[model samples]
Target chain A: MSKNSSNPFTVPEGFFEEARSRAVAGASEVRRRRRNAGIALISGAAALAIVVAAGTMMRSRTAARLYDESAGWLASAEYDVFLANELIYENGMDY
Target chain B: MDRVDQRFEKIVQEYSEPLYWHIRRLVVSHEDAQDLLQDTLVTVYRKLWQLRDPSKEKAWLFRCATNVVNHFFRRKKRELGDRTLDEYLEQTLRDSEYVNYTEAAGVKLQKGLLTLTPQQRTVFTLRYYDELDYGEIARITGSKPETLKVSYHNAKEKLKKIIEEDE
Candidate 1:
């Protein structure tokens, strides 16, 4: 067990009022910063979600158009000779 | 004033000096101590809601103050400044006799305190200058009670030797 020091250090008078005011101000500042951070986080998340959704939609449309163009090209005369050749062979030497 | 307000006011009024003095001792300047004290109080104010028991508030505040001072010291180390008040006092006392017995005693104590590591200094100031119990000091410093006791003892013995050497 230890004894308390007889002469504990003393502070100058009237320091608490000053300290209290500063503290209140600091607390307010912290609260304000926290609120701002929350708002920024929410807005940032929303913006990211919007960008992702737009990107996904754009990618799907681009893919669908690519498929349509390829299908259209394959449906032309360039593909008919190959199919005709296959049929001639399958019909047992038909000309 | 309301109960909470009155109670806090009384606490601020009563403990302000000791806390300030403790801070001043740790930080070594009136201005730095003032800044740290404000920061400490602000933290206490924000966390006051967490303290369910009013009786523990004093200890809680002291603990917070200790942390605040430690943080200030670390910051200063990074910024690279002149020695704190403790250092300055130690240097001064080494040259001249204190003007009065009280100052002589204070200087004597301050010199030994200056020899401690920053963490040890924090423990010492909280225990001796602030008159906080080991448990309170532990709570404030985030150290186990036994560790704090060991730190406090080592600091005290060193201070005692330094003071005795001057005699």
Candidate 2:
């Protein structure tokens, strides 16, 4: 084994102490980054869940409205009024 | 402290010095070794849970340290293609705030080491200075023992030629 003096190189004094401090700091940083990553992953999953639920709800509601409109159109044989039944009313209720 | 935290602290305290020495030799810069060592420690912390067999901690730590050094050199090579490790040492000697081993013999030895490829240098240093066996080095470097033996032999021959040429 290479001795401290005879080796081609040597480190600065207090290197171990400095290394310990750096390791501690590094460990904390890793933990922090991991925590952030976990939070981001959870947030993404939650957002995706909300979006899927909203999409399903919207699809069902739109399907019911379309079914109602098409049925009325078939019964009345009026193309314009039948098409108007498919319209989603947000503010006005003329249809 | 938690069990994992306690284990981590113990690992940091026990392995940092040796790992620092190993890394400095590989990187050829104290500052870079310091940063790289910390980066390695962080990686170890992150992967602590993945260690199924805890008895291999020493080998695992050294392996991780070697990997960090390899990554550092890979990035450096990407940025500065075909640049030699001697050039890095010379630059450090010229402008470094704290490269202490600047003797002629030391520089000659280091430059002679630069004569080999980085993998050869690492393998030889682990064999010669660190006095590790081939099997241990193979595990640390993720290389076959036969390959490491060949590398070590070639490194020895090249180092001999370089030192002789320097003399």
Best by lDDT: 2
lDDT of 1 by residue, B1-167 (tens): 44545555566667767777777777655567788888787777667768887777878888778878777767766665666645554544454321233555665576667789877998888877677898877777888999998998898888888877888
List candidate 2 segments past 4 Å from native: A1-4, A8-13, A72-95, B1-3, B81-83, B90-108, B153-167
Q: For residues A1-87, write the lDDT of model 2, one tens digit per residue.
A: 123433455567887898898788778887789889999999999999999999999999999999998887778858766556656
DockQ score for model 2: 0.33
TM-score of chain B of each: 0.80, 0.86
**Candidate topping DockQ:** 2
lDDT of each: 0.72, 0.79
What is the CA-based DockQ of model 1? 0.14
lDDT of predicted model 1: 0.72
Q: Relative to the unseen true structure, what is the C-alpha lDDT of residue B89 in candidate 2, on a scale of 0 to 100?
A: 57
| lDDT of each residue in B82-110, candidate 2, tens digit only | 77646865676545555545465666676
Off by over 4 Å in 1: A1-14, A85-95, B1-18, B42-58, B77-86, B89-112, B115-121, B142-167
